[model samples]
Target: MKRLLTILLLTLCVNLSAQTLRKYSNEFMNIGVDAAALGMSNAVTAFSSDVNSGYWNPAGLVNMEDKQLALMHASYFANIANYDYAAFAMPLDHDSAIGISLIRFAVDDILNTTELIDSEGNINYDRISKFSTADYGVTFSYSRRLPIDGFNYGVNAKVIRRVIGKFANSWGFGLDAGVQFESKNNWKFGLMARDITTTFNAWSIDKEEFAKVQDAVEGQNQELPETTELTIPKLQFGIAKKFIYRHDFSILTEVDLNIRFEQNNDLISTSVASINPAFGFEVGYIDMVYLRGGVGNFQNELQIDNSEKIGFQPSIGIGFKYNCIQVDYAFTDIGDQSVALYSNVFSLKIDFDCFR
Candidate 1:
């Protein structure tokens, strides 16, 4: 019986790794909500104070000031909508905080058209098909603060899915680990290691692309394999500082680091195992509103001459709070397109702080 149990456990572990291999690239879902609000600083895992943090940094959950539940939704300009971010914290008997969260991203209504071709010049039109990419994902998180000092820890497991036209569909899983620390009087810091395990499972794939097996790896295309395993890299980190002014105004600046062992087909694969860093600043005023802007070096390092400027991701955002509900929004530029395709984010939050 002991041997049987051990074998089963080993099989489960192998299966998990196999799942990651099936997907081409664990294309993370981050459509509707502004990546800036939480991702401006190299994926914003430290935006831990509100519901958005549940998506960006689940480890922040341990720092919740009160036991509460929150729900938030946001939309982006490219017909993308996200339904996420819910967390309920319950202070355990020993001052330890326990919390759970749900996060998701979705995009839809894309257009696709195909041109018919005469396959053999027989005047017979060839079959044509078309479609757009659609994707969604969900993740669950648990977090808690450590006692005896100012430290925290948390974990999250995510399930992702995506489909495009009639060609492909895939699903995958991801895992995250994070920690946070603060001082008695002045300093605060956070770090989150994301996608410790990331994978994508091939759904329906583009038959056309798959059919022509490339001759050389230099071609930069897919090659048939006995099995395809998606590449999920390691390590993403964040750090921050707070500046106080009087009692109502303050400035918080943050810098984050992200490194990845990218897949062969990933957008960032060319710079595999490279560290991409970012910075953000939040200025608070009137206690009811906030002004924010940020930039990342990766953006500038990746600037394309004709695509867009990459010097920075300058972002502007605002937040409003009244009694028990708070709302936040931000606008960002992806260095793509000169005028039309700039990205934006909208967020709505409800808190029961009145009762905390």
Candidate 2:
């Protein structure tokens, strides 16, 4: 049964790779950064206004009061994969800001077993080796406020890199655009168009390294995989409002609609597109301590009894700000309602004003 399963999985992977345009290409970038935003289920599109705004909605960078630096790390898939991120942002004059960010997701020490059995049909443990698979993204972002008060726009130029040990690698490029508007009543609205130019990755494979696998599994992987990959566009729209009372306490609430052109298992699915809605809120005291909670990833999942049920992911987090430094932590998949494993995320942010 184990061998049969392995063969079936290999076939499915090969068939899926035949398509040049993938629905989830470069998906590691979508995992998000900053524990505060992840805890809010990535619903901060409207009010993401720090160094991390370079990844969430660049337009929000204009709200920064000083130069800032951000860093975050998270573990996934039972610690098999490590995700790391860092960013820096500074105001360019009064009306504009610029930032750069880097992200890496990697799985290290993956076993290579194609040569486990030698040509003499002898089992040789020494022939086994280990390699790693990693993906990287670098983004340059610029944001400027418009002549009209409370309006801003931003753009991002992104470069993507992927590596599969010595077997294959690829480079990709893409563009993104974002806009934010604030109303007189303090209502915030934002729109983000990701991969506006459609990202493309061209791979180069090592035929010699791949040849060993072709003969290891007869009739399987006989041909090389596709060399090109395309990532489609996605849109996120958000709105937020903050309610303040008693001078020192406030609550900020936000809602976001994430749209994809292809139909899938999202909550609002159709032939042409699908919409996933996320809702989050933060309670703050004296602008120093905060508590956040959110729910998202709504899906209609198939059950064992041939039935369907609604499943979602929930996250909660806390944050503290002191002088020019901030620290945050989040606990995701609180109830384990979804199929994905739970994760604990942590992040730190510092403002340059402290140095001066």
Candidate 3:
């Protein structure tokens, strides 16, 4: 049983190493934040405002009216994994704003069964241990309105950290930039470039812990795994329009194009790049209640009969705002079209003006 456990662990490590090499490393950062945004299927690049802008498109931070704090939590995979987010943003001056945010995704209390059997060939339950694996990201953002009317730009500096129990850990850094513009007719446009410098994570493995599983297989796990992982750049472009009716009801519609450099299973693929499109809309009454819906993540899936078909994800959410507090809830999927179970996300935002 001990030997089998060791082999399984070794295989998991090897698979993780391969996944890191595939250019989409550190995927936890892409899961997104804010239930309001997720409810719209992450089609908020041009529609984001306030504190949550720190994660979506920092350029929208310039629209913040006052100091604010945001918090969110979601559970996935039958509550085995938890995702949490927190952010704070404040206006620095009439034309500028600054914000900071943190995100964590973790799975806890996993049993370490590789040591279940003692070296003397005796089964010992006391040798078993528990450990957790987690990923963290911290982002610092700054936004400034350009001299041109209705134009704003922002930049982000990110620090990434990952841990796999006591076996390995990594630290990484990256940068992002974004811009937003509004037209006279309530039209909005946005562009965001993520990992513009190509994020890199440098891993350090604990040799003593890893050695226990290094020889689990006869001809595998002989050498240390790759020491570095790289994440390539991706781009998002968005457009939106807002309409008001009778001064009490309003509607907002938006469309976004997500671009990846390499060809893949996206809806529109080519050798140079692939494009995935998202559409979202929100209906609001008296600026206090909102209903949101969206469709995104278009992909090509292979059917059991060897045929291919297109698939997409649909999401919906609602929000209420009164005084200086706002609460939002969303029902969405953490996975692609293949996912059977959906995740429930909730978020809260508080504006500091009331306290002052």
Q: How far in Å is the alpha carbon of 20 misplaced in model 1?
A: 9.2
Question: Model 1: clashing residue pairs?
Answer: 21-229, 21-230, 23-200, 23-201, 168-204, 169-203, 169-204
| TM-score (all chains, Cα) for each model | 0.68, 0.94, 0.93
Q: TM-score for model 2?
A: 0.94
**Candidate 3 residues 1-70, lDDT tens each?**
4555464466446525643534578788988898888888899999787898888899999998889999
lDDT of 1 by residue, 13-107 (tens): 23334334333254444332433364343435554554445556666665556566665555545645434555565545443455555555544
Name the runs in model 3 displaced over 4 angstroms: 1-21, 215-222, 334-336
Worst 10 residues of 1 by lDDT: 211-220
Distance (Å) between predicted and true CA of 51, model 1? 2.9
Model 2 ranges off by over 4 Å: 1-16
How high is the CA lDDT of each candidate model?
0.54, 0.88, 0.86
Ranked by lDDT from best down, the candidates are 2, 3, 1
Best by lDDT: 2
